[model samples]
Target: MRLLIFLIIVVPAAEISVLLLSGKTIGFIPTISFIILTGVIGAWLAKRQGLQAIKRVQEQISYGEPPGDALLDGLCVLAGGIFLLAPGFITDFTGFFLLIPAGRNIVKPLLLKIIRKMIDRNQITIYR
Candidate 1:
């Protein structure tokens, strides 16, 4: 909750400051165009990655194997898509990484390790 509040307040202010500086240096039209281009490219990459992840998950299900990492990849792709839709370079760069298969694989293990530790410590609970 606190993180969310900090992100909501800080991210926009930071983005606006960066945008202003970029606009001044590169001109407003070019800055806006760059943002739009990043968004379009990010969306395209996200869609491609999302479909691949889904297909992999389906294959795992059919093989009676767990799709643990695939699920995480799908989540990263979704987050990337959302971030891309938001107007900011920092978010877009992070989003681009999330949309990449290699990046997803790298992040998945770290996330799983953290999750496992939390579960072991009983720090997280599922209602269902």
Candidate 2:
């Protein structure tokens, strides 16, 4: 709830500030071009990573192993791609970060922790 509120308020403000500064520094056309370029690049990277993760999941399944890590990777890539689709510098940066392997590894544990907390609080339930 707090995170949702913070993002709703802060992300737009930060994006606007960054966009205004970029426009002033590099001119309007260049700023817009840069944003578009980042979006395209982020999308490409996310697709590549998502495919790789899916492949890993398939491999794990073939080996009769759980694909938990690969599944998380796919989720992260999906989120990164979604973020990239949004037209904002802050989101673009976040999208690129999430699309990267090292960044995904860094965030995976945090994401798992949050999920565990949600399960503990009955906000989420898992059935097997």
Please, what is the whole-model Cα lDDT of each candidate in the order they appear? 0.90, 0.92
> Pick by lDDT: which candidate is best?
2
Cα lDDT, model 2, residue 16:
95
- Model 1's alpha-carbon lDDT is 0.90
Native-to-model Cα distance after best TM-score fit, residue 33 in candidate 2, in Å: 1.0
Q: Model 1, poorest ten-residue lDDT window? A: 119-128
Residue-wise C-alpha lDDT for candidate 2, range 1-128, written one tens digit per residue = 99999888988898999999999999999999999899878878988999999999999999999898999999999999999998988899889989999999999999999989999999998786
RMSD of each: 2.0, 1.2
- Estimate the TM-score for candidate 2: 0.93
Off by over 4 Å in 1: 123-128
lDDT of 2 at 114: 90
Candidate 2 residue runs with Cα over 4 Å from true position: none
Q: Per-residue lDDT of 1-128 in model 1, one digit per residue for the tens? A: 99999889988898899899999999999999999999999988988999999999999999999888788889989988998988978888889988988788888888899888998899998553
